[model samples]
Target: MGMAVVTLKKGEGRLLKSGGMWIFDNEIDTVMGNFENGDIVLVHDFDGYPMGRGFINTNSKITVRLMTRDENVDINEELLEKRVRDAWEYRKKVVDTGCCRLIFAEADFLPGIVVDKFSDVLVVQSLALGIDRFKETIVKLLRKVLAEDGITIRGVYERSDVKVRKQEGMEMVKGFIGPEFPTLVQIEENGVKYEVDVKDGQKTGFFLDQKYNRLAIQKLCKNAKVLDCFTHTGSFALNAGIAGAASVTGVDASQLAVDQATANATLNGLSDNVKFICEDVFELLPELEEKGEKFDVVILDPPAFTKSRNSIKNAVKGYREINLRAMKLVKDGGFLATCSCSHFMDYELFTKTIGQAAKNVHKRLRQVEYRTQAPDHPILWAADESYYLKFYIFQVCNDR
Candidate 1:
């Protein structure tokens, strides 16, 4: 049989034309020829102009994810190898390769799959059906590509156990892709060591995106009283402790996370200065405020408050409340580092909310620096979803 062809509706494909990878179901006028879901298909404009090639999955609203704009290039093992090599090469140039995001799905032009390297272990998350079929191939290719640099991959694990996989018509599953090794992998970033649990830890076992953001706070922490809210595994708190913070208090709602974070602190021999407390930040912040507690440096690294647009209003409220409280907690002329990981909470909105919070709390913020996710998670311009994290550092001052 000939290749299946997907024709875009008139005036559709705007996002695709601008270099995005997704083609929504509503954008496609029709599909001609025969092919199964997850099969490679040819894409065409409304007037039958050849557009590109992509994998189509009717199971997803994102019907097609373009692999290439060139209609002539064949999608084969050679192309896959090239994609893997290019991603690895880019990381080698831009960020530390020891433990970083190797492939960031659409940002890397691979679409629908993310691979994180923790030390020698590789954790893969395949979120789309079309990419699910090629996960093993990509992993093998990545292993081969890394071996070229004399880097041996000890093990590979799958962490595709996300609810979004159900939307893609795939069962959520995770397990060792190859011979099982120890799940807890040790990695060092900016002189801070972490034991990443690739098998059961959150989101491929760690948040590698904040690799540099955590480093940015080091200088401001020396001999400073530091408070790290939502300190999962004590990444930021430990960094502060390492930077010679006078004292560090890290809080998280999860006992598991607090235990892990406490273990990490002990692992670094920072248990004396850096401590983990199991408490809801929302509750603890107010309680600490009531007791007139203050810190020279306050870090707010909460999880995504809003995952989708529908709940953005509530997310804003959550962000504003925590930021206001954090500002109150920071001593005069001290630093506050706040961030939002929700893509729905765009930069403009997040900044506006922070400003509002500062005004309400009678605090003045002197902008220090603005940062995003580490370069390893490159933000592809047209793919807005690739750019989720927004971090800001500011010196909080009481109004004169």
Candidate 2:
């Protein structure tokens, strides 16, 4: 296929030059050029200097998500194989253990695509229109790279159940790409064992990024009563239980998550200490307060509230509301581990929102620790925005 030439308007080339992956629609001088969706476009400065080669989609607000900024790059099947192999090599070197986040979108120089490898199998998610068009190439490269390394790919599943897939004009696809389905695979994270459900569970079956954070909580849960809110799959609750928490209450809105959490607790032999409850967290927080129940350690990790810039205001309100009630439910001198996965909400703003929420509840707050995604999920130094996960470990001060 021939590549389309796309020259950016004045200053539009700066982002690409500085290693930014996305090119917004308004930044393009497209009056002189028109490219169909999924077309490979060679981007250039207005002065005719080449910027990069990337897939273009006029339908999306993100006009271009650069796959490669190299002027000589083609981004075809062979190149895709190299990218996949290179990503795997980096992960293998960095992660001595078998379990880690294998591919992080822009951080690995491949925009709009994320692939997570749990042992011999792989789970891939296409998040952008441009990447969706190249899904075949990605799959081929994954198979080739695995074969070349003498590793048998037990299965390759497509879990594009994320909302972003619909926005990209692609229906959610979930199925095994390879010949076989993988049974639940065991992976150890910071001494805790987890079974990942790549074909069925949320986000490639596990939140590998929170692997370390869960371990951090284990230290404080000795004989403690822990409340794990929005605990999908019971990672925190199970950790607390395994760490000798007197009791762990795990709450989630999704019945499936509750069931999964229960099963996970049983798998880890922590069902005796952990209890799973399926309920709306927004309502349950208040109900816990009404029941005069307080926790020694509280964990609140909700799904992203703000997907776009327009939803920032409402998202902030949601964050503050949850944090406020969460703080109240934590006994004085206890820890409150709050997290925001929303990329639109920066770390500073997220913490500030939680602080404001604590003040509203008349609780004295002391920042204990700052946390982020696991090491396998490396963030590109050039792309700070890709560092979307932010966590805060705070203590409810009693001195007032």
Candidate 3:
């Protein structure tokens, strides 16, 4: 007959009512019309009050991802173009567009898709089945939007290889979306250079969210000895070196990442002062402590300790252990920059974990500054998952 309608159970859709984008499968009461899993359907409350419109995926626990709050709106080319243009415009104003996240999924009102710009290349990640159908259209629109500003997109790549795709009943796949170009895309940020491997690198090649966070440590690193743990691709360590750190040692367990970080250091002409070491940070931290090694500044940019809530307890312990060891390695009055990239590790819990670490090591922390992800990764207030990066800089002081 007409478009399918989805009705939410009574007292459900609480997250959607509060400006969030997801409607869980359990929250839906009934389906009124036949539709495919990825079809756009009308959604209403238990009493038939129209809620909004979203694409439905029965296979996903997050059944509906609302595309709009307006009952009259249609999902079409015009709407997609507007979304693409709005995301690009916002990035041009708030962050360095040379290399940054152009669209942060639900945060940009385009749920289940993320697009990143690295110089002349664009990387697209489609996480939901509903959005996968429109992925190509969004990419074309984005290319056209950037072209209007005289920016030529030489290549477009799809990195939809994340495990979450399986949750949505889709295959994890990655390859060139159009004409094949070199997968190794070189770009610059904060006066440092990097080669991003879109075909293989983690999470769309690089972490653009830490852009300004890397810049934040420059002044403090000048002429100081620095340690960068979990230094993926050497973003922080290279930033320290470029800022004239006397010496910078970057550590990561991945040999590929270490090699990439080493190449990046050479690209920035900081090879002599900046070095990459392939070692497990946990084991190395305690070894450094035993050796009585100290640094003027220590940076801990670990990968997400917990991807799900089920593992949060262990994540807290991991965070506490690393922070405690890093604190012990920091000279008195030295700077310690730490962060948690997992949304499961919320701000309050992460802060408390770090506090516990400092106390366990008998060290006091003088708060210097607190920051979230760069504006390009805007934290939508009600969408807590969009606000993952929690960064804090502190002065670690030994008890007198």
Candidate 4:
């Protein structure tokens, strides 16, 4: 049988027409010819106008993820190699080559595949059916591309253990891609060192997207007493210590995370000034407030409060509460570096949540700077998911 052809319902390819990479099941008018799921198929408008070719999965709500918009382009080894090469070249220009996100799913034109480089190790999370089929090929191509730059990846670890994999009918899995090497790898960013645990850590072991954001915090931390909440591996806290902060306190609910963060602090010779506390930030914040604790800089880098729209109300409450409590802990004229890592929390809503928090605390915020994830995770204009992280620096003015 010839390749299956998908015809869009009359006026249903609006997203595809607008350069978006998704074709929902409801958008299709008909599936002509015989094809297996995950097979590459041609896309056409209801009037037979060629749209492009993509992989279709009846199991996914995203029925089709466009691979190539060019009718002449073929999804062959040559095309895949070029895509991987282009992604690597882009990272070299936009981020630190030592550690960065090489391919960011749809943003890099490779839908649903994320590859992060940590020192000479690569960690991958393949999140979609179409990309899953090509995952091994992409990994091989990525290694080949990096080898050209004198970067020999020692090992690759798969961390596709997230529940989202189930949505695509994939089994959650984690293991070494090939011969196992020590899962722990060391790398330096902005003059600070870290031991990233690629085998088992949050979201591919390290948050390379915040490389510059941590650096940005350094300039404001000199001689300041700092508090870094949700300090996973103490990245920001260590940065504060390296910047000559008087003292830095890093808090997390996970003892494992706190231990790792503490070890990372020692790795950077920052142990003298940086301390990690294993405690729920929600509970710790109230106790600190009760103690009349104050810090010259309070950094709130919490995990995503909500990943779905249904929990947005609860997420907003979480954001507002932590930010308000954090505001009270900041000394007058001190700084607040806050951020949200949930795409569901849009910029407008997040900013408004913070504004309401400040208002609730009767505090005036003197804005300093607004930022987002590093350029390594380039945000595509039409793919809003790439733009999830929102960061803001402000002077918390409590003139009570």
Candidate 5:
């Protein structure tokens, strides 16, 4: 195969030298030759020496996502297979639970792709132009890796509804890739059981990234009155109930999510202590406060408020608004669990937003735990930008 080398201008190689995987279009000085999207090309420095091997996409803002910095190595099926196998090996060694993020995007050195393994099924999402173009190869690699491990995967479902895909000029597509669709599957994590819908529900049927956070809240739930706002499928509320909360109330704008949450609660035989409301959280919180409702714990895990840089300011307001309301509702000293999946909002800004909210409510907070997407949604060290999920568990305090 003919080789195409991409050269970077002075100082543009800093991110690469620092082990970062992405190279934006503006960072490159020249592309020696034309290469198809997802084509692995040799990267050269300003001095024209081979620097690395990476996937290319001229049409993307991110022109390159490097797979390796080793000059002697060639990027091929063998290398790809090795990466997948290595990811599996790491998961096996650390994550004993069947429910976990199986393949993280850049952390696995495969940018723009995510794979979540639940029971016997695998849910994959491709958000980059290069990865979307090479999805067939990725699918084949997944199957081959599972087969080699003597594991028969029941299905491979696609959940590529991410907004990033649109920027890559790809439309949202989802469904079963195998012979049959899985309407529901039972998964156990941290000794808690869950039934996830991989076909038509949230990311691969469940937010497996919150596995640990859910379990953490479980330990604090005994005899506590819990309120789970934006309670999609009631992962937090149900976990609270099952973990021995005196009672749990869940609220969401989606009746579908409410229905599913109710069904999940019943599945675990915790319906007696759990209640669901299909109401917009923005309006419901104040009503609950007026009704003299107080909870020992409250969870606020909303969808991404900022999809791009343009929406960040408004998104911060949204985040701060929800947090301020939730913090007020929690009894003094009660736990407040809040999260943001917006990549455009960094942790510092997110915390600052929370701080502003706390000030607005005239309340103080003590952060107890800081969390991110689950281990399977690996944050590649060089690619902190891809690790967008953030969570903070705090204890509400009285104003001085």
Candidate 6:
């Protein structure tokens, strides 16, 4: 039998019409077939014009994740292999294939699946039951696709232990997808070496999205004293050290992260200049201010303050507080690099929050540059979720 059919309400699906990939459950008018959660289904409008084909799940708010608009396209091994190959080829042309986001879920047209390649290792996170069915196939296809380019993936690991799985009514799972080897993988990026812990580290063991942003801030650190707040695994501080900074202090609340960051500094032979401190940045920044401490460069790469829309107000407060304190800590005429990783804090809201902080502190923010995630994490227009990261560099000066 052919795939089941789905119909959307009138005036709904404006997002899909605008090139987005998701269909909200509220937009669905009726489901006209025996399709359970995670089953491939055909979608159509109220008038019965075909919209697309996608995976349907009653368990998730995103009822349908459209796979392709072409009705003739079949959902099979051939299509899966093509998606993997197309993603790889796009990455090779735009990003360094040695380390990058191989598949960015909806951005790469493979909804609910994320694959990151770190050297010879691939880490995958499949969210929905429908998408999870194809996780292994995607990995095998990816391996074969890379083999054509003379690259061999040493191992594949699954990082599906996140809570999003529960929303989809799936079990939390994390383990090796194939033959097990050392989970500790090493890779170099932006002239710095990192020992990525694929088994237990945060977000696929490393934040590949900030690859170039780290390199952009390094230019302001030559012979300077730098402070990197929320320095997960010490990427920013290590970059400052590699850029010839006289000294670097990286602070994180997680002791495990600080310990691993210290190890990373040693691995890169940068222990002499780069150091890690296990402390809450909020408390430490105030203490530094009380002691009249300042730095030539200050970086704030804090985690997403709010993961959901309800917490956006508090998230703005947090971002403003950190940015205000960080601006005060920068030496006169020096530099500050700051960013928010949450899409709930949209670009306009983020920039406005920063401006309010600058006003309250009575500082002049000379905008150096505004940047986003590297090309590997491509932001699809109209798909607001694809565009999350917002980065900025500024020179701080007293309002004379």
lDDT (C-alpha, whole model) for all candidates: 0.95, 0.82, 0.95, 0.92, 0.83, 0.94
lDDT by residue (1-400, candidate 1, tens digit) is 8899999999999999998999999999999999999999999999999999999999999999999898999988899899999999999999999999999999988999999999999999999988888899999999899999999999999999999999889999999998989999999999999898998888899999999999999999999999999999899999999999999999999999999999999889999999999999999999999999999999999999998899999999999999999999999999999999999999999999999999999999999999999999999999999999999999999998
Candidate 2 achieves a global lDDT of 0.82
Q: Compared with the true structure, what per-residue lDDT tens digits does model 6 show for residues 196-247?
A: 9999999799999999999998889999999999999999999999999999
Q: What lDDT is reached at residue 119 by model 1? A: 93
TM-score of 6: 0.99
Clashes of 1: 0
Better of 3 and 5 by TM-score: 3
Worst 10 residues of 3 by lDDT: 378-387
Global lDDT for candidate 5? 0.83
lDDT of 3 at 277: 98
Q: What would the per-residue lDDT of candidate 4 be over residues 1-400, giving only the tens digit for each residue?
A: 6778999999898878877889998998899999877789999999999999999888888999999898779898899999999999898888888889999998999998999989899999998888888989999999898888788889999999999888777789999888899999998999999999998889899999888999999999999999999999999999999999999999999999999999999988888899999999999999999999999999999999999999999999999999999999999999999999999999999999999999999999999999999998999887777899999999999756
After TM-score superposition, the amount by which residue 49's alpha carbon in candidate 3 deviates from its true location, in angstroms, is 0.9
Model 5 C-alpha lDDT per residue in residues 72-136, reported as the tens digit of each score:
78766787788888888888876653777767878887778888888888888988876676676
Candidate 5 local Cα displacement, residue 145, angstroms: 3.6
Candidate 4 local lDDT, residue 135:
89
Give the distance in Å from residue 310's predicted Cα in candidate 1 to where it truly belongs: 0.5
Give the poorly placed runs of model 1, Cα more than 4 Å off: none
Residue pairs in collision within model 4? none
Models 1 onward score TM values of 0.99, 0.92, 0.99, 0.98, 0.94, 0.99
Residue 138 in candidate 3, Cα distance off native in Å: 0.3
| Shift of residue 19 alpha carbon in model 2, Å | 2.0
